[model samples]
Target: MVVSARITNFLAYSSLTVSRVSHLGNGSLRYQWLLCRNTSLLQLRSKIQTVVPSITSNVSVPKENIPTADALVRPDLEGLYEDIREGLTNTQPELRQIAQYYFNGEGKAIRPVITMCMARAINYHLDQNAPGVIQKQKKIAQIAEMIHTASLVHDDVIDVADSRRSRPSVNILWGQKKSIIAGDFILAMASGMLARLQNQQVIILLSQVLADLVQGEFMQLGARENKDERFAHYSEKTFKKTASLIAYSCQAVSVLSGADSTLQSIAFQYGRQLGMAFQLVDDLLDFIATSAQVGKPVAADLRLGLATAPVLFAAQKFSELNPLIMRRFQEPGDAETAFRLVLRSDGLQRTKELARQYCNDAVTQVAQLTPSPYQQALVTLAHQLLHRMK
Candidate 1:
């Protein structure tokens, strides 16, 4: 157990800068960017030293200062995660290998963690003696994560993305065809897991989520040539592509736990709002977060001809910017210009406001739950989704 110090520093620096940004004066944006850039460089240097220790004898770090993976993961979900990880690794070795490549290397596993938290919240409130409840919850969480990972794999292929989680993408490592096959394999495996639940409602919800994911991809692909119309299409796509899974995840848990229809609807709404907020924030991070922090090139969405929320908002103010954004991002300088335009536009602020509104709605949805630590954690999770830097 010891975790990497680089991750600890990234979290520390990112948190500090995000907090300081709120108090910054109007003219201090450049200064803030410099601060972020310098911190990111330091973080990168630290990572290089860790990955290739002998190559950099000049770099020395304190062992005790490093944080553990356990610190990032919620302790309440540890047992559940153990089961999920075991199942994933044992059942589908190839998918597990790819998943391990991504999971062990980066990502906070925040989504499944949230799913487990919601499940535990329900379990705490009702069904004190529900047999096999923990097993079912863990399986659901794992299946959800598998579907998510599969989507990312396919997304990288579709976007022609070279990097993910600060490393070369699976498509880059193994080739696009293999990457696509791997994604499809994971999707099939995930479906099998869902079928085991023998719950028709869960199966239907997840099947619809898969369909929405595909529809979103197609929508983005079709809208590539039309810049002026990209915003509406992109917004609708984000709702289907990103928000639907999250919404259904909440609904799935509620149904599995035998909660009333009203509670299930509330949970679904909470997740939908939170997922929209999450994607909006993700779009903002593409412009604001550093390459090292975000684990992808800045403005990657724009480069891929996929208009994200911030870019859509920015396009509203500068109609002339649409042509520039529609151009395939294959050119060397296109991404930089897109980045600067987004930064200078009011879209960033507007997108943040929209995300905050959704976060507020998420909090309201969960407010009806009786006061408990898990309920408070859900509210905090919603806020975290809105405010997280990466």
Candidate 2:
């Protein structure tokens, strides 16, 4: 039987598939992952073309050759930080500083970039000769940044993180109490901006993201005993925490473009898939990336006693990890042991494979739209997320 190109490449790269790998004597799992890192460019190009023909006929082009989604949003994002700062300004100088801390143009602004790209793509889909992005669409991008940054501030407080993007966290500079208030302030401003859109449906859609963020945090604080249920819980939390904002922002842009329900749903699906892919890559990075590379602590999830995708996948091969996961990895050496075991297992590889699946789905979703540069950018953006180092 002919296997799908995705599965073929995935299986070909590793000497042992997950099912075939098991513990050998001396309690060590025996596996070798000889991936295509050393493959010639021509070979990689051929493989990508086979796996995702829908995105491009001639694939595996050098990074320079791909249409960069970042370029598409550069002009619009130029003044984004300034606009956010203006909105977050407060009478009290210290409060204003705290509220506007993350708007200093240091972060990647991935959410806004995705929102702007989706908005333009939806606009062009509805009208082949549509003008540049409308004011309301741009507002959505700004609101997305604010919502995302606000979450980061609150998360720093909860995670007790001292650094973010390689800089001191808000909670570290301003006490935890003040950081929480500053985060709330940013959210309030974002809410006001969202309301100004004057589209009741858009208002409701974006509002749901706020609720999802809170609920996701609550879910992250605990673990389930059942393996099946634990994975489900993790999936739900991932969606609520990361995908909710992106999915709704894309849908709101479609609605603002006057696209019908079908188009709106299409936009939502694309963003949902892309967002999930982005988070999976992030989770994988937590285990593999250095502090300088990720701009934060390495293995942060494990340090926080959170069992992310890599740890969960590793647990399947090592039953010892189950108790550690349930106890939140609080015991001495638990985090270190789990981290080492995950690296030895195929957990990181499996996470990357799952991320590729979501990225593929995202590409497929965006392809349904009328062909345009903006639409193509969306597809490229999904692929970029799958391979991003940070």
Candidate 3:
């Protein structure tokens, strides 16, 4: 039997069919993935086609292809340090210490990197920032990282997590209450900085991202009884919990550059889709990756009773999972049972397709912007996400 699916809701619509077979270089199965491209995605697919396989290390990243991390962040590195230090500051030394607990200089900084590049790319003066605006845009990047770290601190408390980025989480290093306060302090600092930016629109945009984060957390705490509502709820929650900051950060930089609404929306759209795609990949990782790779335990989401994209898609064919999802997998053996079912089903494959669809939208969104190596790096970044096994 053959199964085909459309992961349209995430972005573009296209039915993909995967057949059981031999092998596809990197993995066990000889899957087409078709890696099918709908007409809407073709332009995007073609643009980044070369970069995808290379960044995936099917080949090398080569010297002259796109902007590297240094190429993008080096110029603004000193300012990022100043801005991040400023956000973590407090007169009370202990409070300041707790606030800076996660700033160990090991973060991937994907959000800030994207924001910095987007700021430069969207500026009317291509390949450069508009004088005073360059400094402000770098602040936006700094703020993005600060706000993201703040959320992670709170999330560790929320998830009762002990480790992040392969180290003891803030909640583990400090106590939960202290961790919570630190998270709040960081947020307050970020808010004060946001106010100082003095762009009401920027404040409103980032502020809304804050609200979405709350709503997304609440959504994660419960599951909808209806199948359709469950999927819709999960999608929105994914955006709120994962994508909002990335979306608004992109839009905020566009705003900083004095781009019009249409352009700002395009930037937001790119980030919104990219952020969701990022989380979907994370959800998928919970099942497929090892604890060592993800810097946490495997099946973390399922163990926590969260039905992510994989479980939801698996439920479409495995009736047993529907009841399990509704009950939050509280039954004695529910998580393991659901885990076994997902492993045997096409859920992983389908989820990958869904994520790819979003990346396609991400690529398309940025395609409209002025072309530069930075812009190409953005596209390269989206494709690189597909290859992140961890």
Candidate 4:
């Protein structure tokens, strides 16, 4: 779904890029067709002209060129999706409510599903006859999700988001004070769940992850105005806010199941890369995805004064975009203009490339593990992560 002005221009001026367009996921391709179909080439050109005002003409699109939905949904992800849903449902009632409201609705549950898949990958490799492996893996998956859910509750309060997953946010439904308490409650529950495992290593790992998560959020808030700051701030925030939990989630299962250090490290690295890629794609989607598709308003991050990877990348090219970004898109119509400028620039492409790199790194890390159906599933999951539209 990541497209640059260059690509749009290419599509407008010539039919060449249409054929070269890659299908990352079925949802995105389907969405693309929906957008392209709802507006004819002439109408699309007109819209583009309204925004850019410089583009003068329309382009043609062959009806048969668009890919179908059947091509995108690999059978493997279906089971992972089911397992995640089941895991969330089986948790405590309050936790389950939180999961149902936030996790089930807003998120794709990519991280926890990947955690379970990777754990199963290593588990199946170690001992096919092992007892309780599935149960253990499921519990680990739940814990990962709990951490994520807890963060989201807090995030809604922090961001002052009114809606999530197309519904009233936890803060909106239960007030900010209760929302903060609920977030802390989930964190406490997650901590207790990890403590019950009594694995010093896993407990330490998750504890550090919580710290990193807070630090990342703090850093992001502090660096909101510094457009010239190294992309490392974004990178670090991504790690703490997104990657660390995923990395630990996978690694914890390895330690719980007594995998070798090398395998455990590989799992952690795989999760880290995948998590970073997930956040990058999320940032990309904020600009490109619709309110319905993304489960939140388009450009919500920019509207909230948060500068993500795409905005950061775009700011590098359009220096004038900084004041708008720094001022939290305070000016009237600033977000719309900023969005158009980024779409027109190389920022989207750069962001996609960065996400692709992380996906590649994740694939490489998981490739180190011995080949099995589960390993293949993990690899497929990694590929699926980069291409996800919603």
Q: What CA root-mean-square deviation does each model show from the true structure?
A: 11.9, 9.5, 10.3, 9.8
lDDT of 4 by residue, 8-110 (tens): 4433322222321111100111122223343332242244334432111121121333322122222323454345445455556765565446655346666
Q: Using lDDT as the measure, which candidate wins?
A: 2
lDDT of 3 by residue, 65-161 (tens): 5666447766865556555766677648877888887777777777888888777778733444457888888878888888888888888887777
Instruction: Looking at model 3, report the run of 10 residues with the lowest lDDT sum.
Output: 20-29
Q: Give the residue spans of candidate 1 off by over 4 A.
A: 1-76, 79-100, 103-105, 127-131, 224-230, 325-337
- Which structure is stronger by lDDT: 1 or 3? 3
Worst 10 residues of 2 by lDDT: 22-31
Question: On residues 215-316, what C-alpha lDDT tens digit does candidate 1 reach at each position?
Answer: 877766676645544544555677777788778887888788888888788778777877877877777666566556655554446545555666666676
TM-score for each predicted model, relative to the true structure:
0.74, 0.83, 0.83, 0.74
Once all C-alphas are superposed, what RMSD does model 3 give against the true structure?
10.3
Give the alpha carbon lDDT tens digit for every residue of 1-390 in model 2: 111354455345332243211000000011111112222322422433243213222233235565677798788778999999999775588889999988899878888888888888888888833443377888999999999888888888887766776677788788889999989989998999988878999999999999988888888876655764556577778888888889999998888888899999999988887887788777876655544566655556765678887777788788788899988988877766776677566676677776776677778788889887788888888766665776
- Whichever of 3 and 4 has more TM-score, that candidate is 3
**Which predicted model would earn the best TM-score?**
2
Preferred candidate (TM-score higher): 2 or 4: 2
**lDDT, model 2, position 318:** 80
Q: lDDT for model 3, on a 0 to 1 scale?
A: 0.70
